[model samples]
Target: MAQTGTAGPASIATGPVTITEVVQSALRDYPQIHVSQEEFNASVANIRLARTAYLPRVDGLAQVNRATRNNIFGTLLPQNTIPSISGPVIGSNNGGSVWGSATGLLVSWQPFDFGLRHANVKAARAAKDKADASVQRSQLEVTTAAADAYLTLIAAKQIEKSAAAAVDNWDVLLRTIHALSSAQLRPGADESRIEAELAMARTQLVYARQADESGRATLVKFLSRTGDINTSLDTGRLLSELPPGGDEEVPFQTADHPVMAEQRANVAQSAAQLRATERSWVPQFNVEGAAYARGSGAEVDGHRLPGANGLAPTVQNYAAGVNITFPFMDFASIHAREAAQAATLRANQANEQLADKALQEQFAKAQAALRAAREVAANTPIEVKSAHMAFDQAKARYQAGLVPIDDLAQAQRLVVQAEIDDSIARLNVWRALLQFDAARGNIQPFLQAVNK
Candidate 1:
């Protein structure tokens, strides 16, 4: 999905479950990645919602009513419970029923707000950026996990292979010792010892298979699949050679890391929120234009007009004005909010620094591990060769009655361990390389090298 270079079919397309294919599958199906993507979508919506503040607002209204057209002259304090009438008051009060109605349309818009709207939009955009970074971070996490599990399974497979081979060697040696004992050439105790060693090898093979099954279960979770990982993996490239050390020259860069980017986005979002709050205390200004129509069945002299006269509009009017409002007491609220946002901004900035440090430390550790793995990988072949030579010599000596059974048994065990070490040495190097690039916030180079 996010390839850095072209990879040949051997590593990317030949296997039933290639590393690239697994990573791409995880990216597509992982729930955490989808969650982050949804959050990003919501953040995008919030940006549009914030931008809506710059547009005009229009409201429509209509009404009809039948009531007595009576009015009294008196000043009343403002309250929400009672309805107010706008017509002039006559000297007398009359309850004679008549119909009355009114309707209007109002449009309000803020031509400017000293960049307050802009600050809100910026805040929303920063949140969107943070969510976007979170999505990238999640992708990296899932892919790293899939790759790790895949490699672990490969290691387990290698261990099992070696253990099985050990069991077979021990079995063959046991048969030979039994033959010698039957012929009165070797001690009967030699056969018992060989049996014990073969059992131990079988036990190790069982443990290796268990580890492999467990790894597959874990990998299946990342794949969001329902079954055990039954697909054949093309681990040949992973075991054939070490990921070339050419990438060792590229210096670690923290600024491009997704975790660092998310932290930075958090800080920016907090700063934007603070800016938006700072401008909230400024005066609110808006220009409004409205048009309306009204009708009534009663005349100004307290006389009822003709029937059904108020059912339709009989008069029309229009008005235009500007409004400016400032909440004098909002200063306290603004100060409290600004303080909170300032604290948040500082906290986010601190987290960003912490993330940077963490990435650097991880990279350092991974680099050291890679070097050690390479050294181990380079030395294992020699160990395997020596162990084979020693085992063969011991076997020959034991058959020639020149050495004790214990020496041959020890040599045989060493050969098995050596074989296992050789099998996993290259894989360990590949694992170290995976960790190295994971800490660097990009695994593309490692994946590309594997393809080669």
Candidate 2:
């Protein structure tokens, strides 16, 4: 027995419902969903790396040495000559070893170099900004795609329901024809015609199911998910109430468009790159130093004595100096790079313009589709009623033997066509709604309005 105060299986809601919910769920499970956030984080890391340029750098040093005494020659001496230690001799003997080592720290800072460092930092910052903007654009695209997929699923579900209803209506008409025949008022040929119509309706139902399944598959793929699309969609919630008003406006403003924002960022980045390149012609300055110990030597007749006077090791020395570098050539390459960046900037500008124009056209198209859909939906009820009345008149006349079964079948066909038309009109309204949502951003606000 079912538990008291417990909900039944039929009451449970399944899968994604709201667009926001769908997006959130898909992102939570899909690895590819984080591309935009990852891109933004990467840009932040690059910016941090670039900022390291402003900080001074320090390093350590170490080393070891070995001595050899194999024919170690020194300054040349005369063939045979005895000379005093203070005399101007031409030669010396070499045979000694020195054990010395030292360690020190070195630091360098860009004290001043025209504008080289500044330009590098500026370029890095521009690139970081561009990366950030790209992330935003990617995020917008994902959101739009998610919303579109969800809406498409909803539309397919609605069409399936319409097809099912159409089949049911045809079944009812067929049953009515049987009843009339039993009363001896309708021709037996009418039953055959109605059966044919029923078969057609079933075929349509099969096609509708296939279309709905195809739409669900597309939605799942777009969300980057793994699921059985045939069973994933929530048919029960397919026609959940839409925005209260049958009409809604299409947005035309571009202040929030991600593609436009990305283009603008590209332009700024390119401009900054150009500025950096222009500054590359400037000079750069750095300071360096080294220190060591030193020693002296003595001599004998045409030869220097080994460890003469016990002074065999060399003294260490210390040196410090500054270096300055300025580009004297490569101006041609620099100019070419600047030209390329300028061209990229122009291209980005053109892209921005194109995005604006595309937005305008999309806005107009969405508006037209929405308006047409509303008109069709508003008049569908009257069309359905008119078709029903015509079908009833034809049925009654045929039952009285005053009209042919073919005429009645034609009238029934008109009724079915009208029903199909109404269903298509409803589907079109939803399609238009989805398109408008894409153009404006998302349908969250509209959904909220409808709920309110």
Candidate 3:
């Protein structure tokens, strides 16, 4: 039952711009919006990780060693070579043998991990799509926040104007009462009554100004700018045109909503992940080739040869062929992963449905608020005019000594309250307009309608 009153945040100064312009400005400049854009950009990295599964993987290796050998095995020698034992070799000659100055590259390509590669690719694409939808949702959120801030600022300005008007009306009555009393044409009590009313009017104006200042601060914050907290805006253009009735009867169509779209994309991505997990039963394929060469020698228990020379037989070998693998018994783990993904997909689906329902509720509530605001606004003008007339009669009666001073004061209070009500009603209309715009996922049409 929270009501939209004429009081809101302060109005910002503009040469001649509408609420839509303010909203655009806020969206473009807000820090929150920038943060969201950065998040969307970061999400692209997830897509890259997913896509990497399909690409070939390669590795290179190298090693060097110089160590004592206890019982050495002779090098690849001729089958007829006889055993020549060097006697009592404690530490033999410099017989350092280098295993392959062996540096080789191995490349692996999954020709058919069954459908694992394809499923990974699909999942990656889905994730990218979801990222895109997330960007849209962020945009919508920023735009909506900007619109709300703008509307609140407008309401504040309207309330300030109304309070100022009330003060002026009271000032005029004060002057009239003082003149009549000075001319000996009215009771002295009448002057005191007018003065009391004027004081209350001034107090109301101060309160209104405070509300307006608060609103302006909020607007500045929304724009991500620092400014004077008590700043005032020359909102002359805000009330230039009355906003028209908004389209409130449109049914909720979630297909076009960015939030729902993102959720759907998430579900799809999870499903693709499940498929990828299920495909894990297939074996991976690859092609490998290596060329290695290193020096060698023969040694006998803790002994080394004096002339351990020449590079080891250069073995340059290359082989390329199709490799197939079938999972022996991986059902338990693979199925578990797949099941987890499936559950996640279901959860996302449920979340999407919940979001849809929430949006529908928001739409309904906005429409109801708009209807109520319109009804309130409809009766405000007549009520304000009637209050003004009654105050005039009360003042005349007090001056002629036909009524007590308290009566005139009460009448003045009524007029001021009536003006407040009218101002609040007007501001409520603007608030309702914003709610309606947000509900529709578009505020441009509303702005155009107001312009016309």
Q: Pick the candidate with the highest TM-score.
A: 1
lDDT of 3 by residue, 1-452 (tens): 11112323444553444455556665566555566556556556666776777778787765444443323335556666753332234454554542222345667676556677778778877877787777667667777776666667777777778788878987887788788889988777778877877788788789878887777666666553233444444344335435665356766686777777788989898889888888787666755444444433333353344542222433355656666656678878888888888889899989989988888888888888989888888888898899889888987887677987788778877887787778768667766877777776766666565546
Question: What lDDT score is found at residue 248 in candidate 1?
Answer: 64
Which 10 consecutive residues of model 2 have the lowest summed lDDT? Answer: 1-10
Instruction: Give the winner by TM-score: 1 or 3.
Output: 1
Taking the tens digit of each residue's C-alpha lDDT, what string does model 1 give over 135-170?
A: 889888989998998899889889988888988999
TM-score for model 2? 0.75
Clashing pairs in 1: none
Q: Could you tell me every candidate's TM-score relative to the true structure?
A: 0.88, 0.75, 0.76
Question: After best superposition, candidate 2 residue 32: deviation in angstroms?
Answer: 4.7
Q: Score candidate 3 by lDDT.
A: 0.68
TM-score, cand. 3: 0.76
- The list of candidate 1 runs beyond 4 A from truth reads 1-15, 68-70, 73-77, 90-96, 180-190, 221-229, 396-406
lDDT of 3 at 141: 74
Best-fitting candidate, scored by lDDT: 1
